[model samples]
Target: MAEEEQCNQFKKYQDYFEKQSDLMKKYDETLFDRWLHGEKGVIDQPPQHQGERRCIDFNCCHSEMDSTYSMYCQTSRVPYCHQHYSYTRYLQPPILCTSNPGINITTKFVHTSINKNKTPVYCMRWTPDGRRIVTGNEKGEFTFWNGLQFNFACLSGAHDTAVRCMTWSHSGGHMVSGEQGSNGSSSIIYWNPSLAPVVTLKTAHSELIREVSFSPNDLRFASCSDDKTIGIWDFNKQVCEIRFDESENAVYSVDWHPTESLLLSSSKGKVRIWDPRLKEKVGMFSPHKTEINKVRWNKNGKWFLTCSKDFKIILHDIRMFNKPLMIFEKHMKDVTIVNWHPIQEDFFVSGGANGVIYFWDTEHSKPIGEIPVAHDGAIWDLQWHPVGHLLASCAHDQTTKFWSRDRCGDSLEIKKYQGTNRDYDPIIPMYDDDLEQPYLAPVFIPNQINPSRINGFHDI
Candidate 1:
């Protein structure tokens, strides 16, 4: 019986081997067919598998196998296992917009900041082309900045004391600056940007120089001081040709007529017009309740404007001196500076001690717009760009700001040509290199006097 049982077991093993061989053959044949037709097939018999070689640590169940192990896998899928990868997310950055507001929109404060140096900036002006800006500080420092860069490129010592006032010549080739000394010695220095003063005109003014302006026509320029004198200089001769001392108080402001050969000055609540050619006063008007602080002539030269410490703007017709054609009051505090638009005759701006700037239209007594808190401290000076719609202002807080009129009309256009760069083509060439020589005589003026008199009767 034992022999019979052993023989039966051997036969059973043989039968199992045959069955496995047949299954292997069938599986190989099915895989070959699926590969040819690009289809998948299922396996029926379970094959004997060896235990995997694992890492030394029993906690690790992953097998250490050759990189080629992936090639023998039945499935073509691969899995990645990282905590950060499973929870990954993505986002896009935000965009910024800097579009300007419309014209009808009210005046808006674009920016404001206090200068850290604490040195008061007295005067500020943009370059003729509007590419750069220049500022004078009370610490006797002058800084030049390319507006786009927003950083100063050139800084130099401009004077021993504070630089009181500055004006660019019509040609934009040079600039003139006035320095107020502590010892009551005020001097005007002409700068060529390449060398020292081409012309230095010293005055006997015992106080600070208040105002300086270049003539519309290129023959001369004017400067006024607290010494109560207005000095007119001949540009060619580089000397003071006429001095007017009609004010008991200091002459605070002076402006040149745009078309005529006339000059206007304000001092001690009085406004006086002078004919430099004849060296005599032509008109005098006192319509201010308080001290006159500033005077400005319209671009058309038909009228002039004056502002006062009484918070009023008086529009004076050159022909009508007894009464202002229009008187407008907008500021609650003293009006410190008034500037007319370079091209528009109807519009002007005024700044006050309350750090407010008002834009006015003479046709209407009310202000078109106003900027409150335009500066931290009192606004000392304000100026308009010669061509564009930019306004520059200085403050006692040692900061200067630039403002642009909110004109958003599609019809607004700027056309620039190569030859159109020269605005004022002098009938004669003027340059600093020719300063060593003497100046020729100015164009002769006809001696004609108007019949209008201040006392209502002509003395002549």
Candidate 2:
């Protein structure tokens, strides 16, 4: 009888795995590791098996060889044994996750301050004056910085959750931040160094808010959220003046035209235009073919840029309102954000989920250069240095990198000047300053294969 009972129990275990065998073939161990560590949420009740079923981890102290164990991965929803559960405790970095095949940079980023205290940075913006920067983090904290120093006035619990969006007014002295709601409630928190909750608009949206923008005049602000509605708020009253309900899909980004009364929003693969003065839809643009991630009004506010999850960047002339002036498709992953160079009208930069930052010449619709591994993970936000060609980028890697123009290399030399002339010299012999040397020539790397070096000539 005892032998028969043991055989039946073993048979049931075999049956359970047999039923899941097909899906098991598609299971990825790396993905399983992410899910087990709570890196990804695959199911609602992912803690582990409950009740008399006991822990699925065979390493459990109370576990016996004959004990029953079962648990499901929330992401894969696949039943896994408990012993496999404790495997994460003795974590080994996967060999596959470490190798990064990327462009060997002739130009590289200079990693600056690493904010270890805050949760990963989500959004960032620079004051119009460019003297100060404000960053919002996943921990719902607001960190203000000047130069490389952290300000003493960092605001804690500014949002109670990740601050997904931040806007610094063009003329006003205040900043507005939007947070992802833990519940169905979302709010906007306005702050200045001196005041806490200078003004708080609670329950500003019915769901998590994705972005917020203060108008050019700072008299009004606009917000978009997962609730599929856009809210226009009156700054003085601290109340929503009106809401646009045209989009059935959640709005991801919104930007107020720099000099006009118009506002632009990206949602449901559509570009929406709203006339805040009249509180009505003025016009709409449909250049994007997928959900848009970000929209930005150029310096003059005449042209705008929009990037989408479809990996396309479209430049729209606000006056035309119907067609994209340029369509850029250099990104390999869904794009996160786009920013215009403060001084160079034709120059713009974009970052994507793959951690590549591309510098583009909008007039040509092609990438002029790139930072191959700007971040190890997706970049969340990018801000151009207010005065120079330096760019500030924040990413999922928990670091903010400041990239500067490589004045002596790559972009300026390789493509701009070199072209196809391997023999092109910076200084002509007639214009040579040094009479003894005539002109400077590139030094051939010692013992290295130099395609540009003449092997027959040897070394004079």
Candidate 3:
């Protein structure tokens, strides 16, 4: 609905509309939501030809800035047409860190793990003692590597299809493997790590097993699959002790709580914490609006993070359980995995579709650092080096690259800050129609749009 005062100010447009009153009457004059919020208010000054060319993000259609348009919406960082951009140039702008110019840290990693085996590495794991590294690739082969030289100890093809996942039993004597592709294909191999299979479990699901996590004890393990099931396997008996096939969609990932009592498994849109002993779901919730590609718990198990297809990473506090502790949105496409720094509980890294890895802090919702192109294609997995600040990112690009930091910046001493939010209910938008071009006052307009009406808020 049009605000009354603003409707009266249309006296000037009324004359022009009179020429085409019949056709104009067909559509209501209510502005789009952006204009109603007093956003993109007219830019009063043309952006000076600054040569620090800003790269266009995927959200922008054009490869570069158009000379006719000034700065677009600063918050959304997406380009808009003349009509849309002209109205949203104002409202509230973000208050950047100024107490100190806050040191800008660069993310650099020592490239140590790229083993180009002509196939993308699908999964990776470290031995319990962190002495050996095992990786499964797209071609259904496993490459066991020595921890020091990163030399291959053995390369074996035990599965007929892509080895989708791998995990070691608590004793580190046996490893569980999962595979994908080809219906009714054999899956789930329990290997003794000498290039031999201990007990090969047949496919319970029609498709691939996305993940397998050995429970804290060697007696059991949990596996989630595309068949929409989470199975708790009794390793000794070589049978699934219990199976949860209730997910409405494909189950994508699985993990065991450190306590060993709760098994965490996730499907598209929801995460369920199950008590395998009771054969019941203890807690289940949709952590993100989009598909939850991976769920990882912090070492202490107090918090866990979910990476999503919606480019959202949410940290969940098990105590609160109702709402996310914080939210991070940065990736351009689906976020495949998230791994907390084993030592640094508050920081984590997420990588997805484009092999881009983002480093985030749980206390804040934005990425503090990023590796724009860590791989050539979709990054399928991320594992932090068991010992240091280094991280391993593997992708569909057929290689695993290790990133190690040479230097981490010292913490900044932040001072007092001001917030635009008031401790009241139903807060008002920073600027309303009345303040920008108050509805109470008549508005002036030219017959056509031009940079002549450009006002404040130009990009730096």
* Candidate that would win on TM-score: 2
Candidate 2 lDDT by residue in tens digits, 1-460: 9758656654553454356544352443333455457653332232222113211121221232113222211121111111222322321111111111011111234335566583688888766665556677888876665533322334456778888887767764888888898778888988774435688888998788988888878999999999999999998899899999865788988888888888888896888889988989888767777889998898788899999999999888887868779998879999998987765666678899998888766665556456667787899998865553346788888766665432211332333321111221231122233232222132322223323222111000
* Candidate 1 C-alpha error for residue 85, in Å: 41
Tell me which of candidates 2 and 3 scores higher on TM-score: 2
Shift in Å, residue 97, candidate 2 = 41
Candidate of highest lDDT:
2
**Better model by lDDT: candidate 1 vs candidate 2:** 2
Q: Which stretches of candidate 2 lie over 4 Å from their true place?
A: 1-108, 145-155, 193-196, 409-460
Q: How many backbone overlaps does candidate 3 show? A: 16
The positional error of residue 130 in candidate 1, measured at the CA in angstroms, is 1.2
Clashing pairs in 1: none
lDDT over C-alpha atoms for residue 11 of model 1:
55
Please, what are the lDDT tens digits per residue for candidate 1 over residues 393-422? Answer: 788878777654321111111111100101
Candidate 3: misplaced stretches above 4 Å?
A: 1-107, 112-117, 193-195, 407-460
Provide the lDDT at 33 for model 3.
Answer: 34
What is residue 75's positional error in candidate 3, in angstroms? 42
Computed on alpha carbons, the lDDT of every model, listed in order, comes to 0.61, 0.63, 0.62
